[model samples]
Target: MKVIQVMFDTLKRNALNAYEASDIQTPNFDRLQQKTVQFNQFFAGSLPCMPARRDMQTGRYNFLHRGWGPMEPFDDSMPELLKQNGIYTHLVTDHKHYWRDGGATYHPRYSSYELIRGQEGDSWKAKVDKDMNIDGLDNIPDEFKQRKIGSIAQDLYNREHMPKEEDHMLYRTVEAGMEFLRENKDADNWFLQIECFDPHEPFFVPEKYLNMYGVSQEEFNGWLMYSHDDYTSEKADQLKNFYKALVTMCDAYLGKVLDFMDEHNMWEDTMLIVNTDHGLLLGEHDWWGKNIMPVYNEIANIPFFIWYPDLGIQNESRNQLAQNIDVPATILEFFDIEIPEFMKGKSLRKVVESPGEVNHEAILFGYFGSNMNVADQEYIYMRAPMPGKEDYLYEYTLSPMRMNRRFTPEELQGAELDNSFAFTKGVSTLKMQTSDFMGKNYQRFGNKLFNYKEDPAQKSPLTDAEKEFEMIEKLKRLMEENEAPETLYTYYGLDQIHSVEDVRKEHEVLDREQEAVTEEITFVNYHVKDGYLTLINALKDKTKAQAMKQHVQETKAAVTEDDIRNWIKDNVDKEEQARLFYQLDMTLRVD
Candidate 1:
């Protein structure tokens, strides 16, 4: 039997809901859903695209690598295993990150792979221009350039004027998949992975789909405004409508692929699985995009579906907590292959045969970058580090009333003490004021407990009680069993350096040089006029002053006296004393 996995990027479960609620229809997906076993409780192992894709391909927890960028050289991914097993693996995607040199290692593991470029708005521009029969001109107006950039406005204009022809990436990807399916109908067993890069950022949909939802240009632009603060109730509704339209557009394409599969009778033998890497937040919790906050269910709880024509587990829904890590093991098990010992996920085939029999108690999630949200099922925890500092832990109940509302220090201190939260016991560190010493925020070992059954939305923290001890103990055991050793290969510093001695020598040289360099001195003078302290750069250059003003505007903070002094110290080698004086003058004006 052939296995075809069609993965859509950022396809939210709510998108399906919205399509059903509105006049916009997805006949293909709807029919496929009827024949497939829908998994309602599938969650993402990691987030923001790449990490989740790694989890799906590696069959391991993302935290094992500390949420680092791209795939490491030591990563034992599934595509390699599939290739070794003679399962002709292929990947067709437009995810820009996968094209990065450091990130392309995973792509090579596949027997065959294709990358479709043109992110932002340019993806549709070439096709639109070609369809419109536009001449090759040396220059174009800003308005025309903006349209070519794939802006929402330009897409609307295309629907009215050009209407996408046969040149869209979406159309190309679908056609390629359909053609492959037809050619491989009776060939050797294979695995085809098709990734669609749509319904992501810079939301744009054809007018055909927009018309189904009755969305207008005013409503679409108004929805864009809701991405930030100053949102209104009316604006929120319009944004919701616009987002719904985009989902419908995606669904329309999904239908096309499904119809092709059905026409070729591919579903009879193919193990068809439809799922997304992650989700998007459209005005949920006052946020419009993915990375601004934690992995709420709106984004984390993804849509997972599998269809096996010969299997009896059709038209069923399971709520057992499953994640992307299980995907590799599931595929392997389907082919009667043994799962590797290092794999972190169990085969879902058993659970599918005996629904409600599996006991998956808790799932762990972690975020590594600027936005961090770690949680189980009951309570959500956050750690937002100050610029150039270690993160401080903040606990919160997941209810809308408590989200983003700071907990008083007294309240945190007064909570009943218990061993519900895990604490990292093995670690020693010399604290540094600046995060530069550690390179990034140091990981703190801690434990968190949640009552998922009672509060699936994670609205409240578990209270300390004798009855909850078992649950806490089980969670700790799971965490310990799943934890993987961190090797030097995974560390950001070690990964960059050629050898251990190189890393040590680089640091040692810097440490020795630090003692001989003398600190530089500078001053800023502020004048009070009309009850306002106006600061001016003593070394005056109108252009430099304007540049500094622009910098302040962009960073949303004035260049303070300390900032200027640091700038001078860092760049003194380039301009000597002149750099110090100019920076000092700029500092006074910023203050």
Candidate 2:
């Protein structure tokens, strides 16, 4: 028997809906829908990519540990468990975060792994540009160039906005898997995990797919509106279309792998599971990306499908509140192995045995930076930290660093009625910053109650009733018990023991050197060459050019230009030559 898991990164539910409405047909997913058991109400365990992956791989709630960092040695990851059981586990993915020194531990735990790099957004755009022969074109419209160049530029800057090259990674992975199957087909049972980094962000589909959306680039941006207004309405719409296109593209690639399975007769004994790490936020709650806001259904809810011919469950949809953590337990159950006692998720075998029946009461969701929530099928309760007086005062003065530095009453006057929300303002009075509080003890801030059945979007806040208060208390207890380590506080200087002397000593050197330097040179070198191409494209649009110039000026000011230039010169050991080349490169590229 063999188990195959296909995981897509940041595949949003709305993106799937858009693909269904588009010209392209996702027959592969449709087939899976017909033959496999699908879970309509599946949710992510934790989010912001790596953290969620950690939960899925380890079968443990990440809330019990610190968010997004190295996995502890004690973590009993599923891949390692599978390997111990004589199951050859393989991982194929293109997520660069997993390759980082601190992040790569999880990959090597598997028997065999492949890290497919250079297939991110810019890399995919470069592939598209190279394939389409757009590099030499001088007559391209500024908007089109902006779209093309912006896609690459955004990809270079942000990993989330990178391209959906999961299909490419999948193809290569399937090829490798097929080879492994040919060799190990007659031998031991194996477990293969094919993870795709796709449908994430900076959504850039091939032009051919863009044509299928029946919308211009300008019209497409409207669908991509995030919480921050990072993309204009026009840009958002295009991104939505691109996201849909990538989903369909991924479906097409999945179809190829399924075909290979059929041709090799591998489907007969194999248990295939197709799912995603987490969902993406496509304009839900006025947000575009995943991390900034609360985990709405759009991002938390995911599609889970399992196909096992021997299980006798086929073509069924279950409205079970299954978390990704269940996958490890389910696999263990399938092999007749005992599920670990510490595992929080239950096996899906019961649901598979009774197709339509499920018992899902409540599930927990959390944000590493801010809050935690406990949502049942009916209601959602969110608990977030309230900003104290010092926090409020700092917001008005824009002083994030100097927490102990007090502002005068005049400086704190207008701050009372600043941009804070009504609920936040009300609770702010009861709270105190960690800095102001002498002890490490803290209180839960404000708790939000919502009837999700009536308000799925959570637009209307439910009043704090007796039941709501009880629920909030219960959730608060759970949160305190399941709290991740206080890593953020320690790293951000909030947990430091700073004396007045310590503060003065830290700033004294800087104060003394403030006027010591003059006539400095600064140079900013971008690692990606295409970043320069993007600057060139931005210059063609007068508005964008001005914004670019202002951005450069601000950036230069933020990190002393002279200091940067001198560092570069000293590092390169060719002062005049490096300076001349750097300036000439920027000038030639920026028009």
Candidate 3:
């Protein structure tokens, strides 16, 4: 038995014709629709990029304990499990995050892997002109102008290195996967993951695909890569068109794989899975990007398709809710390997074998320290953190690394060694205190209750108190089932009675005492210390310094250019700025 999984990044579910009406035509996805079972209610468990990937690889949600970090020592990675069970696993990906600190532990789990770089700000090419100026780029905010210019310039530099369309990172990644299949077609009991970071950002594609989308070459605007932006409707439409063209490019590449399967008659033996980590927000809910806003239908609800040729399951649609966590469990079950006790996800193969079989009553998902969201096939509830209670969050992880760097000394200053969880393999881990740098964006959007049957757009928050309570109960139950920390219940203002029993009991008396003493205890007035301010000023990276400056300015604090200049000179050399910027950019993307 063999399996081929093609995972596309930032693929909007509605972009495919089989999924919804879209200006972009994804015929290859439509073709796959006929050959596989499409999961309509499939949602994202963890958020953004690497967190979602973590959920896929480990079959467990990581957002509850950690924000964004590498695979823990105790993680049960399906590929590693398969490799141990005498099954060959190969991974080919253009997703550069795998090289970062948070994602570094993932790709190494495979028996063999290949990486193709130059997706977005990869620093792949050496001769990029950072000072390249873009003239007449109107309505670009001053803060975003430099970033926009850097992205365009780096893309221009990278494009110069790729003389042919086939040399593009996505093309190379897919080609590598196809090459592997061509070389090892006769081999049995192997799993191949062909993941591409295309249709993600930069929206870079050959002019031919743009033509297919009826978008002229001159009108080709690069992907709006901002994490948050307010755009004019015209500019938003242009960005959407560019995204459509890139999606068309993805379709063409997918068609190539379909052709390969047809030529080889591989469908008779190999199982094929095509899915995305999560969808992108293209001007949905008046938002231009993800992570900065609530994970609505446009982002949390993702596209999931799987084909098991050996089981004769094809051309079907399953409404039972599933998520990214199920992928690993499905793969493990397909190979007859026992699912790890640590995995909270159910095997998707059971659904394939028995259609419409419900595996979960509700699924929990969100960014760490952000909203704790839950969906029960009827309503989506985003539970807000209690007011003035954001500081209760702690990141429990065996790996102290963030996206591209180690946790700062200050971050780990009050770290505690904890092994309370059953899944931690009885090994204590550093429970680092999560601060503003970890994820200060929590509670920004507030809580929302969206009824899928009535308000699919989630335009208005539902006010049914009973229904909300029911969803909250579901959320509490699922969190406990996943071994959520006791602090999480306190964060939500929920009673500790129904939480993880041992942890709840440990904290119950303390919680009552703390509540009683809250009025008597004098709280220190929070203010930005001079040392912390100096640290922000000492950010040698231009982007990070700008980010800190923007954040400080938003706080209405007085900071000047001279102060920034003096700090830059004192911290790090100018040559190291770009490297630090890349790392900080990756780290802050999660934050």
| lDDT of each candidate versus the true structure | 0.54, 0.56, 0.77
lDDT per residue as tens, model 3, 286-352: 5667765567888888899998877888888998989999999999988999999999899887788
For candidate 2, the 10 contiguous residues with the lowest summed lDDT are: 436-445
TM-score of each: 0.63, 0.63, 0.82
Instruction: Return the top candidate by lDDT.
Output: 3
Ranking by lDDT: 3, 2, 1
Q: How would you encode candidate 2's per-residue C-alpha lDDT over 1-591 as one tens digit per residue?
A: 788888878876545532234444577887877768888777887766777777787676664333355454556677788788887888777666676543656798899987775444323333322223223222233433455555444354433333454334445555665666567766657888877776565444544555667554334322232332345577666666677677776787778668877777876788889988788766665556665455667777777888875875777777767887788888877766677655666788788778565645667765443455677667776554432312421221122112112344544454442333221223232111233221111111134678777886667776545546555545545444443334333422323223434334423543344222211312343212223222323233456445433444455444333433343344333423332233322222210
Whole-model lDDT for model 1 versus the true structure? 0.54
Off by over 4 Å in 1: 18-24, 121-165, 216-229, 369-476, 484-591
